[model samples]
Target: MTPSHPPISGASSRRLGFLLAAGAAVLFSAKAILAKFQFRYGLDALDVMALRMGLALPLFALLAVRESRRAAAPLQARDRALILVLGVLGYYLSSLLDFWGLQYVPVSLERLILFLNPTFVLLLGVVLFKRRVARREWVALAVSYAGVALVFVESLRLEGDHLALGGALVLGAALAYALYLALSGELIHRVGPLRLVAYAMLVSTAVTAIHYVIARDPAGLLRLSAPVYGLALVNAVLCTFAPVTMTMAAVARIGSGAAAQLSALGPVSLLFLRGWLLGESVSALQVLGTAVVLCGVLLLARPAANSVPLDPIDDPLPGQAGNPPGR
Candidate 1:
């Protein structure tokens, strides 16, 4: 029998890609942690979400229009309708929920919830599409979630009920986003990713605007201070636009599921960033838990026989901070 040889270079490339994805995590992890800074400035959550999305829209639109002119993919009316539904659910609604939830949750805790994309994707794929999850993949999913538990414990200590509730909202958002990942590839093939993001943002803006009208959010929009404005800039450009675009690029390279799976490590990374940035001084027990959780994430990344093609539609990252529509 011949001994199997490993693809050393391929492994190296995947590591590089994972590191890039981790870079995405670092940028994304910063959003909510910084948003916590807004309390000093008295910024409302809705107003922040609105501003964040508003700033990002123009930039995304410019690229989307150029892409439309270059490699446009046409879809039938039904397809258009489904895509719209997806955009509203995945990008618009999810963003609203996350920003609102952020007020009640620590950034670290919310990251754990948001990173549940892999679990949501796996369960959704298995139950809805009858897809098979590799045994090792299952272990990875469990480990990724263990990381969530670690973060949640610390988050709970930091923010109490607010953190738990915020984590729950982000979990719901992650589930919706997971569904978006599962189906977005087929949709992207019908329409390019740029256009998909543009349309999704537009649709999300419309939806969020209506919700604001109904709920009467953005009461504090005009009173935003300098620090608040700065956070809004980070939310819109750095967290919303930059990482979203880069993650979409990653989706184009790897598949959305794999990308999302790797993203499960985001909360752990955020834990350290927040600790370093905010002097969070996480407990020794939490550090141990974080390590254990990370080990689970590595298990998920272990080689599988087949890797799925990616079509990740990262409309609204399940992150913290955004300005309400028209805020």
Candidate 2:
């Protein structure tokens, strides 16, 4: 028989998990910064999105092919239909709204808004599924929105232009993604998680391509600057692909709870990075707001009595459990 390998120590496993989770959070947050840089290079949100998705499409296709080969059975008609709807709601619409919102708002604010996805998810459950909310959950939701309001008011005070519009767009993006998460539970069980994500990504990319062609001249995409393409490549590979895999691995190693907890680092990193890279001002109130928001989300993320925990595998995005609601 082959020699058996030594089992990893618990501490070592935990340490590795923390590193992976933290790294995934940072990488995902960096996507906004990368898009901002591309903006300076004269690309619109659609242009940037097209490049990002186009470059990433090949890899996602490869993943889909690999997962398909490993599947025990082919996708059923109902499963295919659900995947199409989710692909539109989750990846395409949500990501497009987010990219457009980033054009008007500071990266710091955008990151914070996306971080509020957990709250949106909770609200969606209450309205759609008629789920009962506990007193603590209500408190958590109130505290979370209060913190976001704090940051929003501060942002308006400093530079008010388009703040409301940008915030609304980002909020819509969060809600759209929340709806996807809520509806995807059963479908995830029907299809394997990796296969589902891969298939959904393929669908989203097709939609992105069509949006780009109809909205803008396809020829212009060929004339973009080298830096634009380079940034798009990095955004696609580093931010999109790498963090997705890393978060999955992290969750597997440490469980979604610890991984999600560690992902609180995303907003914090964005807060500072915005000032350093994008020259956006950072304020004390923003810091406090970030802290308050994290506390509320952590509270909401707390495991319920005898309830199933959030599954990161069910999330199709990078930094899946980085938010309590698996954004």
Candidate 3:
């Protein structure tokens, strides 16, 4: 049921954005699982990113080539410069940092730290747009933040130095990711989601490849035959392509800050999915933690900024961002 809160200036748009963001989270959750699969098969973290991006590059390019036709004029010099920076920061550099940090930190703690992205996004909105969050949004934010803190404290208590480092790296990932969404939100208005993601992924993949060319061992990449390749493909398709596309689409609908708030679901989904897939038993605390985070999602979904005047549900336009791509 829709909450009592009055919707924002654009209720329908915000609702549209929220669903797409959650859809993105479902796909984005696979990142950890696929990375774990690669590690299990003996591929180093860098090698895994390298192989995954190598495959991802062409697919991104194919879309980009098609989307570029939408532009009325050649990309301005400033946009090209921004694209370069965004490509390096959003995907290659930040992702590599996450990989390195994961080596040092505990898994759950890293997720908790990464959850700070919403906070970052909020802070950026305040600073950049003078956008003030409403009371309900604040409450939802608190619940989400509190949930993350509890999980992190519990996770760290059971950890090592590597896990600790992972926590720091994940924090950086959150910051970079926040920057990506905030900036990309503005840029999407200019470039459109499809072209932006396509170009960004293509450039980011090329940038990642340069690192692999310098130090990667070809034998290491080839060691794991079919399973590893399949996992890498899964990582690229689900983790990178699918979610990022939704995120961009969400940005197009609602502002990126709202979308970022919903992004708190990623780690929560990861915990459950990881536990279920690996057959790892979840303790009471973890389940409680997941519930706490979910409460935050339901609260945020209450339609704080926009007013929903329609029926129980609003039918979205075709090719909507939240649905599976091309649906």
Candidate 4:
């Protein structure tokens, strides 16, 4: 008779997932700070974005090559097209808006606005995917928006001139990324999360390069300061690439819902980082708003009533035999 193996405990998997997600969130939260730092050197959003993607391109290309070699089948033309479109939408457009918005807004406010991504995802699910939102989720959405409103008011009081423009741009970025997440489910399952991220980012790199060529002279890229280059490298490796892979791994281990819940750590960490690095003040109202936002997101992250639990065997890494589900 064959030997029996014990099933992995849900609690343990979730714990690991939370750790990974939190790490990714903290790293991702650093992007705004780094971008803001770069801005102090008088670089435009397009220039900063181009440098980031330029540095990251080779790494993602290597990942794509590695993943392609291990892929069970070659990518179809349709798959390539989909990956290109999603990449443009998710990384290129979303990041441009985000970086541009950062020029006008403080890092803390930028993070808080971007943190609304989960709510945007929920809304997209209901409208586009026809997924039903429970009444509890409705309450969560209300609470989350209320928190955002509080922060927005505070931001307006502090930086009223650019607050509206900055908030709108950042909100646009959030919506763009939310749409990417919503539409990527099927493709992520088909391609595997890591492989998908690798290929899509490669496409985004190309798009960003083209944009850079059109928007600025090639000599401009070489003129950036050494510290800016260092920060870009850090952003590329530590923030962008690391978080993308880590978050996917976390999702594979635990589910997307669980991973997303842990992402609530992002805004809080950003607040502290901004205070320490950018000399941004953290007000009492901001703290209260942060708490409300986190609570709302946690409520939204609860597993759906009809959702099935993920088995350990089902949570395979990319290129594994059990690579059927998306992160």
Candidate 5:
């Protein structure tokens, strides 16, 4: 008789997934801090964005190539174009606006604003898909916005005019990214999360490159400070690539709802990182606002009664139809 191995338990698998999700959240939380550090070197938003995308391009390109080779069915032209448009909206524009906003906003406030993405996602679903909102969802929405308003008022008092500009830009970034999330469900179902992310990032990389060329000469990229380059590389690898892959992997294992709940760690981690690295101050009101926002989002994340628990199409098992072996 052949020897049999013990199957992994569901609890163990969920534990691993939670760890991966937590790790991804922490890394992603560092992004604003890293961007702020790069700004200290007198680099403009475009310059910093160019460096980040330029450095990240090769890694994502390789990922795309690997996924393409493994795919049984090739993508159609229409699919390619759709991915490009989504990439431009989600990664390029959202990232560019966030970077521009960071120039004028505190890292803590920037993260708090970005944390409101789920609200935008809910609103988009209601508007575009004609989804009905439950009474609880409405209350959650109100609580979330109230939290943001509280933080926004505090930020305005502290940072003045710059806060207004930065907050608006970051909020725009959140909205753009929310649209990407809402619209990507179909594509993500067809293409695996890893493959979709890779292709989308490659598209975003090309767009950022062209934008950099239009804005600055080739020599300008070469002239960035050493520290700026270092931070960019770290941001590319740690914040961008690793967190994305890990989060997707976590979603695959634990489901999107659980993964998202773990992601609430993001802003909280940012709070700690900002205080430690950037010497940023946090007010009691800001902390309370953060808690309220997180509570509201958590409430929204819970499934309704009679709802079937289904993992997102993006969460595919390894070596499954949409997912390939070895990432």
Candidate 6:
């Protein structure tokens, strides 16, 4: 495949792109809800992580093989090393922190915290690369954090106790992912998005498996209820694997900017899903906070009039600028 394809102009193509992008966002956001569900069955964060990634390992391995064969050239030594580092930071560490945070926080708050990756990426650019921050971008960050604050306060009031720890853990997850995004720009260009994602996921899967073996009883997996295994399968396939593929395909059909715009649906969908499936009530404060965060993030996401069109391979998922297509 080429770096860029001809613009897909038909209404049907565009509509399919919209549906794919929207559905991918919802599916990605639903991971938190799935984790919360597993928690009710006495599964800890590592238990869920082990089950989810273990179940998904074979699929990820196949993706790695498929993308490797499709690559323009074989990966160099440096590229292999970078994949190891990024796989750890982007998927392993970030995902561990996120899963642990879910043990403490509500799904709504967890989704909102993860949704702040765009802002974290912005700040990382300024701090690490000496990139200039536009004034509007600062305002956007402020607005976004203020909204998070509102929800944080509301969550604290209701959930109490472990809210602070959970919020911190999720925030750390967002920051670690931001680091991955900040550093992965050149690698994505050289390796191709799908290839990079597949290889990186394979690396993470290996690390996660080792961690599970060292810290957990592998035999415990067999004792889990059928429902737990069923949910793990759904979470691994529907939430993780399917969304990555669907979002990338959506980016190919539409443009990245347009596809990213649809990502705002993620948190919104999670909010309703939590209420309907988990019986968690939606509060007015949570609603207002969500609106404000969406406004701020969308403001950052708006493309400049003279901006170069983003490559479909550059941004495989929504919710962040140049997000590298894995949950």
Model 6 segments more than 4 A misplaced? 1-7, 305-319, 322-324
lDDT of 1 at 286: 66
Candidate 4 residue 204 Cα shift, in angstroms, is 1.0
Model 6's lDDT to the true fold? 0.82
Report the lDDT tens digits of candidate 3 across residue range 47-158: 7778778877777888898899877667888888888887887788777777666665544445555554545655566577566566666776788778766766666665
User: Of the pair 1 and 6, which is ahead by TM-score?
Assistant: 6
Best by TM-score: 6
Per-candidate TM-scores read 0.78, 0.91, 0.75, 0.87, 0.89, 0.93
Q: Report the Cα lDDT for candidate 3.
A: 0.63
Q: Kindly list the per-residue Cα lDDT of model 5 for residues 241-286, writing each as its tens digit.
A: 8887777677667766566677778788877778789988888888
Candidate 6, 73-113: lDDT as tens digits: 99899999999999999989999999999999989888888
Candidate 3, superposed: residue stretches over 4 Å from native: 1-23, 104-112, 127-141, 244-265, 296-327
lDDT agreement with native, every candidate:
0.62, 0.77, 0.63, 0.74, 0.74, 0.82
Best candidate (score: lDDT): 6
On residues 30-119, what C-alpha lDDT tens digit does candidate 2 reach at each position? 999999999998887788788888898888889889989988889999999989998898888988889899988888888888887766
Clashes of 1: 12
| Higher-scoring candidate on lDDT, 1 or 4 | 4
- The collision pairs in model 2 are none
Q: Indicate the TM-score of model 2.
A: 0.91
Instruction: Tally clashing residue pairs in candidate 6.
Output: 0
Question: Which residues of candidate 2, in runs, are more than 4 Å off?
Answer: 1-10, 305-327
* lDDT of each residue in 120-158, candidate 1, tens digit only: 656776777666666666776777677668767865776
Q: Order the candidates by TM-score, highest first.
A: 6, 2, 5, 4, 1, 3
- lDDT for residue 72 in candidate 4, whole number 0-100: 92
For all predictions, the C-alpha RMSD in Å is: 6.5, 5.2, 7.2, 6.0, 6.2, 3.3
Q: Is candidate 1 or candidate 3 better by lDDT?
A: 3
